[model samples]
Target: MFAVAAAAGQTVRNAAQRQLTQTLGTVGATHVRFLFGFPFAVVFLALVVAWTGTPPPRPPAGFWPWVASGALTQIVATALMLAAMGERSFLVVIAYTKTEPVQVALFGLVVLGDAVTLPMAAAILVATAGVVLMSLRPGQTASRPGETAGGGARPMLLGLGSAALFALSAVGYRGAIISLPTDFVTAASTTLCVALAIQSVLLSGWLALRDPPVLIAVLRAWRPSLLAGFMGALASQLWFLAFALTAAANVRTVALVEVLFAQGVSRFAFGQRSTARELLGIALIVAGVVLLLWVH
Candidate 1:
């Protein structure tokens, strides 16, 4: 249930992000989203603490380092994802980002000594195959300027890179959660708010010095940006709660449903027409994910 809620939150956040793609370049949009979201994050943490009659746990000496590292990775990942959204179809980008689960599992097994079952390995292969099918591009010349080469390769690369960094963040956060005495969800979520605050302060200071015009635009565009920020922060809280309850592998595999969510967004929001092949690809991906979960 938590997993489902997390996925829904993420899907909504993606939709919100998709709307931001055209107005701000990927980096600018992310900057706005994070910047606007920072204050709400603090409010959210306070609300959670107040409602629960609990305070956020004091971090251990090493906890801040882990949280900062995790946050940095996420910042990079979000920036990369924004770049991908600017250059590619929403459906394609979502499909590619789903690769995070497989990447995270590998990272866990290889780096963190988490065991990987054969079934999990098979599931990873199945998911990879789905990604391959989805990424196939028809004949397009690379020499043509402004033409998308190999369909969505460049965007896919950016998306994949983002996914990888996001996976790293996930693992790092999971490890860091052990240092806190409060609810892991609260701890993780609070860490996110703190990290975002750091990012917002640093970026705001940089922008104030370097580019006042864009900063002014962000100030003027506070209405929508605030909505986006609130949603983004709320989504992060939900995701942190879910992560606290479930394994990252489970959470991520279920989150792959974002591809279906993306499909809906594409069909309705952008009038993106899908071919028979795409529909089939979606079905296969869904089935494979279901099988993977069932096996576990």
Candidate 2:
């Protein structure tokens, strides 16, 4: 349930961020998620602490590196994703990001020592294949006409890079959350607050130093940016909660449903119709998600 809500919230947040990218550019738009989301994250942490009657856990010596990795990689991933969104349809961009589950499984193994069962591994492969099929569907190239025949390659590469970075970010966040010696709710909330704080400072400082105008633009567009931030923080909170309960691979593999949410946004909101191949890809993704859940 948390994963489903997170996916839906994330889909809306992505749409909001994508719109901001047009005016603020990718970095500024990415910053909006962290900067504006920080307040909400603080509120969430306070609520968790209040409810639990426990103070936030102090980080161990190793905690900073894990949370910092999560924060930095997430900022990079959001920037890459927004850049890709500028070049591709929302559904296509998100479909490409759906490839993160496989990468998440790999990263989780290496970074957190989280092991994937054989069935989960098979499900990840199936879902990954669906994402690739959706991304490479025959008519996908029609949108890019200005450059040479290889014009489509740039967005594809950006999407894949975004997927890899997002996967790493997920692993890092999960690692940070689990490292905390607290209840799941408190741990997830505290980790979220710290990570968002780090991201907010890092991105805001960079924007201040390098591109003041874009930061001003983000502030000028505060209404939508705030909405995006709220949704982004809400989604992250739920995602962290889910991560506390399961392996990063499980959380991310189930997140493949975000692609389906993106499809709905494309069809109803943008009047785009799915091709037969895209429909098949969606089915495969659904099947993989169901298998993963059953095995879990």
Top candidate on lDDT is: 2
Pairs clashing in candidate 2? none
Tens digit per residue, CA lDDT, model 2, 1-296: 68888999999999988889888876788788888999999999999888899889998977888888888888788788878778755556666787899889998998888888899999998977777677663543455566333236676688879989999989888888888998999999999999988987887788889888887888888888889999999999999999999989888878878889999999999999999988988998898889998997
Which residue runs does candidate 2 get wrong by more than 4 Å?
80-96, 139-158
lDDT of 1 by residue, 76-176 (tens): 78778877777644545665776888887877676556566787667655655665466554554443356465434777688789889988887666656
lDDT of 2: 0.85
Q: Rate the local accuracy (lDDT) of all candidates.
A: 0.71, 0.85
CA lDDT, candidate 1, residue 159 = 78
- Count clashing pairs, candidate 2: 0
